[model samples]
Target chain A: MKRRIGAAGLSLFISATLVITGCAQQKILDKMGLSVVIGYDRVDKDRLLGTNVLHQFDPMASESVQIVASTAYTSKGTRDKSNLEMAKKAVSGQLRVTLYSEQLAKEGIINLVDTLARDPTIGARVFLAISKGRAHDILKHRYPEFGNIGTYMYQTISQNIEGESMISPTLHDFMHDYSSVGRDTILPYLEQRGKEGNELVISGAALFQQDRMVGVIPTKEVFYVKLLRDRFQAGSIEISIPREVLGKYMKVSQKKRGNDPIFLVLDTLSSSSTFKLVDKNRPQINTEIKITGRLQEVSEVVDLSKPEIIHKIEKAISQAMMNEGNKVIAKLQKLETDPIGFGEIYRSSVRHSNLTRDKWYEMYRDAKLNLKVEMTLVRTGVIE
Target chain B: MKSIGKPGEHQVFSTFFLFWVIIESQIGMGILQFQRKVVQVAHHDAWISVLITGGVIHVVVWFMIRTLAKYESADLYEIHQHALGKWIGNLLSILYMAYLLLLGTLVLRSYIEVVQTWLFPEIPTWLLSSSVLLLTVYGVLGGIRIIVGVCILSYLFSIALLFFLAYNLPYADWRSLSPVMEANFQELIIGAKQMAFTVVGFEIIYFVYPYLKEKKKAGRYTQMGVLYTTLIYCLVLVLSIAFFSEGQIKKTVWPSLSLFKIVQIPFLERFEYVTVSLWLLVIVPNLLLYLWAATRGMKKVFHWNQRRSVYLSAALVLAICLLLKTNLQIKFLGEWAGQLSLYLVFVYPVILYFIVLIRTRKQRKEVK
Candidate 1:
């Protein structure tokens, strides 16, 4: 009993001693400035310009938010520089979005992105996008609707990513594609629009070869990229069909809009794509896409009561998808970007392929895309 | 005093405890980053090396159990005394005890390194090491049953710990697993050798043998533990290979933790941060098991009370943990420990089993 008491006392003493030592550093929320969104622009070969949008919660402060622009040679350097310029310590624990200028992304952003990837504080879910011009301009604009530029852009990208219209541009995906030999990084392309430039528009996706932006494709074509590259559920797409296929079943009131392609919107879409290397010698890829969805809208209304109409719609949609798929693949080939990962299929499907980035890029230009699409119109909304 | 420790009945535990003991011992801080070193040599086919090394573990463990089963309630120390005689046996036991202490030190120091880097970067090494050492000392004093209970908890923690890797599944590019047999036999052999430290710690079975109530079933259950560990290592290796690109895995210091860096959960902004903290449960059992074995060595070989040895060993490990100033030094210590474990845990056991067999045969003939 005496020994037990002694052991308990010793444990308590040790705990007390260590607790009092207080080795780890503590950062109180009030003392530190939390950066939510950071923007980067390349000024020269050796210098970088960065804009830090910090969140302000202090009631005593005059400004509603804090925006500090610092010029540095590295991303961490900018954070450190901005910290010196601020009233409080700058911390990236709440960093939600990172934006790169088109010029900076064109010059290659790996040297800039490496710091965030290496740091433990920055999360993998942080949104990454490319501004059409200078990222500083986009980050500097304080829109009336948004309180914080960082979270506003993050939510914008996050919502679209969840809805299936936007390609995922998270830091994790960027690093994955950046290092992957067979795939390239794709990021949301942002442009400040409207008369006063108060509105932020995610106009397209910026395609990257290695870390440099090689080309930009509008959101309309990005739908085809999504169809080929990713699996989607409850995703909606608006397709423009020629009047020739749908004119027969057209609603009488819609005849005034003659020769304009019929618009069809499909919602609650579940799509699966399969890529198989049928011929490995020349890197020919056979892609099979199966899509099932309910028709939510049609510009020229078609009779939904007939099985013949569904068959015609399927054939017409399949034809339209095949043509768009061909165009996207051709554009990707021209851009020398393998975002569809045909090169990955080559490397994975073959033994001792020993694929290097440059080598795969060369083969990717000539790689045949054998495309097939099977669309199943499951329901015609609540009507049918 | 007898060469073997004969603890009271309350200290002894059931045979199922051996299963958790083997697993809890083998999987520790090593699993956090072993893939980095392993993939360096074997490239994408590193999982094959992990598989081959796992096969060799069964043979090594069989040798250990066979040698220990030859005597009633005798452990590594007793077997050393019986086969090699007094002075030499005590010296060997002493070295093994020190190695066990060093094993504890390695676990403590590496865990501190992880915490310092990943979670609380400002925490001084002395405070954290002493804190962990104190906890280990407190746990070990409860004896083998208490250590086994901790090991059981560690089993659940290990599952949740590695389950963090599953979060990287959607982005997993499994094609990296293709061109699987590209690694030459030599590279595979080198890679398998590199996995030594990670798959080790099953050697504790030799030390814990006397504390088991059903020693007869120890071999079968012990083998089961190793089998499951192999399955887990393979599964993790496969997942890691599929999850990370070849170039990316090469750059990653801790492939397992880095796998969680990409996990996007609603409630947890940074999942790896939470992972680093919960890791305390996993490493605590390891510290307890090794500390217990080393203290038991003190009681058996030097006739010191376990209570005295527990504090002494924990302090020694804590001192090393604080004194190692840099991660480079800690890494160097780990390499040295890894090489030593190769000889002591893997090669030496089979040789000892032979000596035990020969010595016992000779003694029977002399008695006749």
Candidate 2:
């Protein structure tokens, strides 16, 4: 009889426990607003002009993504204020991309990016970029071609990263570079252009001295940065070589670029770059880059049957890449930024350099990037 | 003095189970964030600190086993009473039980903190902790074999999570591990000392020694368990140093969990959220092992039923978890436990071993 009473009480306690776990307010998918992309622009002294692009979950909603722009003293404050205007509750669980204007990035966007890194709901892989103009302008505008600008921006940056044309500027990378000594971060620079400034363009990448954007590497020269900074799984580049190099071994004709600098597009390109800190006192980096790819297209009609032509093209491509790489390094030094991670080489190679961000930047200013580019053209088109 | 903890034939388990028992207890909450503490001391050379610390723990565990092996089936509580007189021994045993209860409370607090901050934002502390602590109660209620089953299952399920670190490989700067031995011997030792906090739970061997079916081989299996836990810590600390910048890792509270942030699963939007929820299963063995050890001591010291003591321990740990509502309190709780275990778990066992050694030598002399 006593055992039966104990069993009845235990059953009641077990059933009661279930109700307590479900007490938190339910976030039904349809009713909750998922903030997909957020843009933060600096306002007055203590406030930030924040823009949130809400993903459309309702079928009947006319617009694809709802844009909410507001100013707040803190990042979360902006979220709460944006929530006041939205019908559904705004949540950051699906936030994919965060944009900061060049103006904001100049002052340093770590304060904003840290919150993203701190939020467990926000992914470390979220694309972090810099806008040419106000970040609000890039996020709030609607284009005639695309419905969801936020996702389009995410897809563009991600596909390019996958394509190996750009270095990753993820929240993880940003925090890693920010907290790590000796290395700085580079972020993809975005601008809205093409008639009424609604079309999105990836013009360049912003070179950051620590957290602040110090200079920009144009889209054309970004190849050189990627070449030095990261290894390519599979990347392609269009190199315009002087017609003289190829003219030696193969018949060349001028069709474009006036001087007939033949546009040689190398596809299925893979590369490995090694940085050696031979001269630690002055910081001279001897970079050895080996690139292997097949010829996908030649702007000018050229015969591909001969081995001499392939060797000549390879040599010409190597020389052009070397020159471009040096030029990029020169520009990077002038900007006082070490996006290629010369600081890392300097810190690692030297036993006790006591390298800090400020100290490395000084060394980086005098650092020279000595380049040796080896290019191999395995196959020239489908023919022999 | 009475011979203690000689279980019936049904209660004895194989030495193989000790491996899971050691790792499950050792891996609680610390794996999530130990790198931050060591990084502050050792800087880039934190991995070395972790490796050396792991080496020292092996020796400490050996001494613990030697002491426990002196008795036929007695655990730390019984050994304490035998080594010291009954009052002094039981007092020491009570302090050890308190230490076990504290570790269980800390594991509960930290797991609940992660759950609140990550997966479920509005979860009340009482609800989440009670839900988890109830599992500990249930596991303890079942028996030693049931708890071992949970630890083995916890071991199998949680080992797969380490593969997620592969996602951070592309962004990894292996060069960051450079200037590796730059830290002085003093700094390396300091780093290792800080790491002592994370590696605390392996001393469960003191209580778990008697349950082994083959006591002769328990040393090999127990050492292997500590070795596996050490390797796991070394792997995580090395990866974290490589994946994060020296300055960036210190800013992170839970470096290992942060490593899981970039896990790319096509179907799952955020993998860390899933990981934080799944961690509920991972931390269960920590509670089970600690609470199980505490209740046994409680049963012997108070002469109470082990079942009733299990309830008392779970409720006490739950109350502490409830009172530790803020982050500061949780941090204090961890620091207090880590500091206490540094002496009790690592240093005290060696002292106790010497005491037992002297007492037994004196007893043999008198008999001769």
- Write model 1 residue lDDT over A52-83, tens digit each, in one string: 98888888876567999999988888889888
DockQ, all models: 0.01, 0.01
A142-250: candidate 2 lDDT, tens digit per residue: 7889999878999999999988888898889989888888778999999888999868988999999889999888887888888888887678899988987766555
Pick out the ten consecutive residues of candidate 2 chain B with the lowest summed lDDT. B115-124
State the RMSD for candidate 2. 23.1
In order, how many clashes per candidate?
Answer: 0, 0
First chain of candidate 2, TM-score = 0.95
Model 1, global lDDT: 0.85
Model 1 residue runs over 4 Å out of place are A1-384, B1-4
Q: Model 2 — TM-score against the truth?
A: 0.51
- Listed in order, each prediction's TM-score against the native is 0.51, 0.51
Candidate 2 falls in which docking quality class? incorrect
Candidate 1 fraction of reference contacts recovered: 0.00
